[model samples]
Target chain A: MNIHLTDQPIDVAAVLASVQDEGAGAVNTFIGTVRNQSTGRRVVRLDYEAYDAMAVHQMRRVAEQAREKWPMLCQVAIIHRKGRLEIGDVAVVVAVSTPHRADSFAACQYIIDTIKQVVPIWKKEEYEDGSVWVAAHP
Target chain B: MKLKIALFGIAKEIVGSSQLELEAPERQSVADLIAQLRAQYPALNALTSFAVAVNSEYAPEDYCLRENDEIALIPPVSGG
Candidate 1:
């Protein structure tokens, strides 16, 4: 398992490579990208921040949970990027390999969903007028 | 006891610092710490919700805190 919270661009290829396994017959991946618009507003960019130590710790727990929930999973890798990101840039990536496709897909989904809920990371959506922290308010 | 709590995301922004120090009586729960924080930083009360992490793990409201426990204020997470 590999988990990271980085200020630099996320290398999806590297994440996929880290999950490669000869015993694994299937690999599932999820890439989260910064979109051009948010909630009907035009987004210029996004600024992401994280409590690095705790974020990484929570990510590891996500991977662990996936492993426990899916025994067939061979490996898991998650990378989340921080700092300013333009539209279309990758913000996060989750890759999972397993002996079969079903387990890979399930584990990958779980990792991302859990990360969204528990990871100590935040993103500020920058619009032409101003900015707002995503999910900071109802 | 004086405990230092790490702040993240909007919590850091609202407090205007990355970390804060607060005074807590012995065997204080996470709830007490949050109450103190909300009193000092009223802006925290307006957030959707937040969690308290003790020693890098999300702790229950009743979890007792200790000195140098590395507590963190986890504002609503938005990561993927």
Candidate 2:
């Protein structure tokens, strides 16, 4: 399991390499990027803030859940970015490897969906006129 | 009895102080603490979805509070 919160771009290929070993026949990845539009407004940039300790803890918990549900899983990597991000920036990256393709896909989806619901993170949208805090979740 | 509360994110800024000392009688339920919190900090009125955490873990509305416990008002959750 690998979890990272950093300004540096997430190394998707490198992370895949870590988990793609002999027993892992399939790997799945999900990349979340900063969207150019939101709620009918043009987004210029986004600033993400997270409680570091809680965020890391949440990631570890997600990984633990995946391992528990799927014993065949080989590895899981989840990385999130902090600080200001442009419209095209990569906000989150999730990759999972399992013995088969179906498990990889299911586990990847579960991790991403769970993260959206439980992670404690806030996003501020910077538009042309001003900025508005999204007021909820990672 | 007075209980201390800690605010985070927007709530923290609106309350002016990261922590506030609220006056509530002993053995008050978590929901009671919220009522006093909303009354004391009118700005919190805008926040409709806050979870009460006693000693850093989630507690239901019926959960009771003690003076020794540390209560946090968690803002709406966001993650992904």
Candidate 3:
């Protein structure tokens, strides 16, 4: 139950440790990075923002949903970074541990997907010539 | 009654403020608040979609808003 929206760089090892469990045989982790290019434009950087309190609340719901869906899950950790980010920087990390590999993988994917859909967080893409808020326009 | 609403992401940019206070008749619904906001800030209508959160949880359109409710304007989310 380690859900966090942090402003600092995410420590992958720390995130993994938070979900460590002796009963779990598999630990599935997903790390989302800021890619250098989006569409046809070369992204210079990205600015991430969150409605901090609501973001955390929604992330907790995502973890809860995962746990309910995957009874075998031992633990869950979701860490998302905010503020300025450069190309290749890690933006988010999702980790799930379970007795078997399949459950861990499924739960990890579900958590990340739900977070993107429900969390009150946003990222602004900065290209060489201009900037735009991702998903802002219809 | 007057209610204060929190703005985030593009909503904040569109309104040019992080928070705003608006006067509404008592027991107005969330949808009414949104309509009022759109009337005041037409730029909000340009977004793909948006949701209203009351006390950090997504509120239904028919949900009644109370004074001092921690309402937030949620623009289209793009988090990973």
Off by over 4 Å in 3: none
Can you write out model 1's per-residue Cα lDDT over B1-80, one digit (the tens) per residue? 88998887889989999989988898899988889889988999999998999988889999999997988898998977
Better of 1 and 3 by DockQ: 3
**Residue pairs that clash (backbone atoms under 3 angstroms), model 1:** none
The TM-score between candidate 1 and the true structure equals: 0.96
Model 3's lDDT to the true fold?
Answer: 0.93
lDDT of 2 by residue, B1-80 (tens): 77787766667767887787877777999888888778877767776577776654567999878887877777776545
Question: Tens-digit lDDT track for model 2 on A1-138?
Answer: 889888777777787776776888898999999999888989999887776666677788888998899888898999988788998888898999888999999999999998876666667789998877675433
Identify the runs in model 1 with alpha carbons over 4 angstroms from their true place. none
**Model 2: pairs clashing at backbone N, Cα or C within 3 Å:** A116-B79, A137-B77, A137-B78, A137-B79, A138-B78, A138-B79
User: Which sequence of candidate numbers ranks them by TM-score, best first?
Assistant: 3, 1, 2
- Per-prediction TM-score: 0.96, 0.83, 0.98
How accurately is candidate 1 docked according to DockQ? 0.85
Interface RMSD of 2: 3.8
The lDDT leader among the candidates is 3
Task: At residue A10, give the lDDT of candidate 2.
Answer: 70
Residue B33, candidate 2: alpha-carbon lDDT: 81
DockQ of each: 0.85, 0.38, 0.88
